[model samples]
Target: MSTPVLGNNKRASCGPGNGIRQNSLLLFLLLALASCTLVAAQQPPYDVYPEAKPPYYRVRYEASGKPGELIFPVNYTVWIPPQCETLRGVIVHQHGCGEGSCKSGLTGAFDLHWQALAQKHDCALVGPSYEQPQSADCQMWCDPRNGSDASFRQALTDLGQQSGHPELSSVPWALWGHSGGGHWAGGMVMLHPNRVAAAWLRSGVPLFEANPDRKSIQPHELPEAALKVPIMCNPGTKEGVTVKDGRFAGVWPANQTFFAEVRGKGGLVGVAVDPLTAHECGNQRYLAILWLDACLQARLPETNGHALREMSLEDSWLAVIDGKTATAAKDFDGEPLSAGWLPGERIAKAWMQYVNDTNITDDTPPSAPKEVRVVDGELTWAADADLESGLARFIIERDGEFLANVPEKSQNPFGRPLFQNLQYSDTPVQPLTQMRFAIPDGDDPQSHRYRVFAENTAGLKSKPAEVAP
Candidate 1:
């Protein structure tokens, strides 16, 4: 389904007539805000969901414009962690342009893996859907200087009041965006650098230089303030010139220009090229989450509300390409590299493994399910959580025969499968702890044997726990 695009009504007259119309529009917006406040006060806070599905909190805010003009509306959905009492920051996962990606925004907040990251940092996960049609000008909202930025700030205030957390307006932001959404995220950092903790721009960035041919996109100015924010530019390898006529060919040039300008200005920036498919997000989150985790730990304040501690460069390592092979560089000496300044040794190793194979290399499996018992065809067990990749799902086998998988959910359009125990879809898989699988009734009860195996997001399966009936 496509989001309806509302058109603005223009006045034929200029001069005094235009002035009068502008003033009327401002008055109308004020009235609208007041009305929204009244309605919000009467509405109850949205409940947090363990699985992906509807019933999430969403608020629509109109961009500022002349009265009677149909301003673009930005629809925002926020997922607050059920356990977090005080939020430290907020992570905004923005989708690309077009109908499919815009619709994907509905599920971004429901992602369980992102929720885990947010929960660890006491942050809220939010997604914004700009109601721009497929053929519409993406610059209308992607450029933060436009009214979308104002609408986003307003939405935060509205949600803060609705959720009874007024501090939401003051907390820092960790932005993660794809395609045109990347342009939005990157633009946001440039516009409001101090308020942002970090940014991950995937396959898109706002152009600092204006192209006379493309006037639709207003060029953004690179401000000195943005130099402090940590940013990462991730583009697919296939999007480069090597592909010649690839569909996403523009991605590499944009990333190169952006990275050069930002890094040349002494900004904290890095580039991590996806070795796999072009334009498709494949196994990037495995590194994205870890990178964000390190950035947040180094940037966020302690419990007493002190200044953030600086990240030590000495602890970081660089990964560079030597001929056809990938090599780790302990020293950073202004050399051309693939991944520059990995946070730590573990992350450095993970980055190397990822770049070399286009997947996270994790041989260690999750802890096996414990106390597995079957009573009256009902199975119950508990498994130790895998701290590395996080638990994806549990494999159940009956007498060495494949049985049902717990919490069946569909995979997201992104690379992650639903069975991976991550939120790729709007509906999340039910928690494994609360899951109960019914055994087949026709099976021989005495001769039946059940085995349970825990799988991590890396696709590693743990040792099985066997139970005899």
Candidate 2:
């Protein structure tokens, strides 16, 4: 082998020891650089998001107990991703009692609503099915202590432990459920006020009414601490009255009283009463999205008005594309919707069904004959009367055939007057009609399956009214 030349340097050494030492040093330096990069990547840019990942994690867990003696087979779907700089937090979904314990049909019903939230808001969603025993005393369908609630809570805890994603550790979370599930959600919110941030109760019984005047009704009683959070009391107008004797008790006034109590405690309570829908995931899906955005997006404004009062009609609300309220100037109606209402530019095109769909507007007109017209490629309607006078009821009709009606009971935009925990001396209001429905897109306006009607206290309803195409 030719001798290696050392030009103006130390003698060149090809010894195995020197070669090995140089290689080792090079490898060590490479690893150190890689380690530094990893550490930097793992560090979240904000305090809320301390991890390198999205802040939430989806998971499933089981209850550690026997199967028959009130053992509820729970199917938990958890969502709390890593690295959430945004305050929009987690929301847990509780499924209604259906079919068997841990069955797919019952759990699948929640997928649409839960998945929508997860994809839209970048938040986590956890859903659990409560498996009630077949025993006569432990009917899982309606029993509060039938292990459903406990199973869900356990899944939440287990998910938090396994997923090293730090956000679920103490982030704000809301409980939402429908029908039977709504019952559980309400109980959870009342029972664990400190653990849960707030709740959205849909078509469920209020806790206090289970045993009025009983101090033991602690779960239903609103706590002072809960005032910091919110609980949206939403009931579908088309839920068909509470059936007692094969007949409808109509909308229970007691439910309104419960809302009043929660509101009286300075809690955020939004009611979408008499919406253009019924007790289905579609209704919950739309409402829950808005509710979740409100609860987790950021701080909302303080209202000096009655918490149980209806939102105004004179206001043109604005919000983020995701429907979160922005801090903007209020409208003439004193509504803050204009502040944070941002519509997604491309959403209208992508989900034209939502935009084109003829749904009920939360705004109710002042006492005047309302007119319907399709304006600027949007189905728009205008009424000149206050909501209470019945001159502006949100009516549902199809193809000139009367379908349903949501009568107005007050001057408030939301129709019904705010029950001030006391009776209203003025005209215990009665709605002109109670049927509520909506027209779907792709339906013919002239021969469409449904149309909306507006009537005044005089029982005079609009004629051949159709929203703009």
Best model per TM-score: 1
TM-score of each: 0.73, 0.45
lDDT winner among the candidates? 1
Each prediction's whole-model lDDT (CA):
0.62, 0.38
lDDT of 2 by residue, 1-469 (tens): 1111111111111101000000111121011111110111111110111011232333333323443223333344454433433323457665443322122222221232244444445456664433332221112422345455555544445566655534444454567755445556666666566555557765553455443332222235656656545565555444433332211122224345555566555444544443333333333333445555544433222221212222222222232222212322243233432122222222112122232231323333323223455433333454433222224355665556655545424242222222110011111112111133334456554555444555543345545455544
How far in Å is the alpha carbon of 2 misplaced in model 2?
76
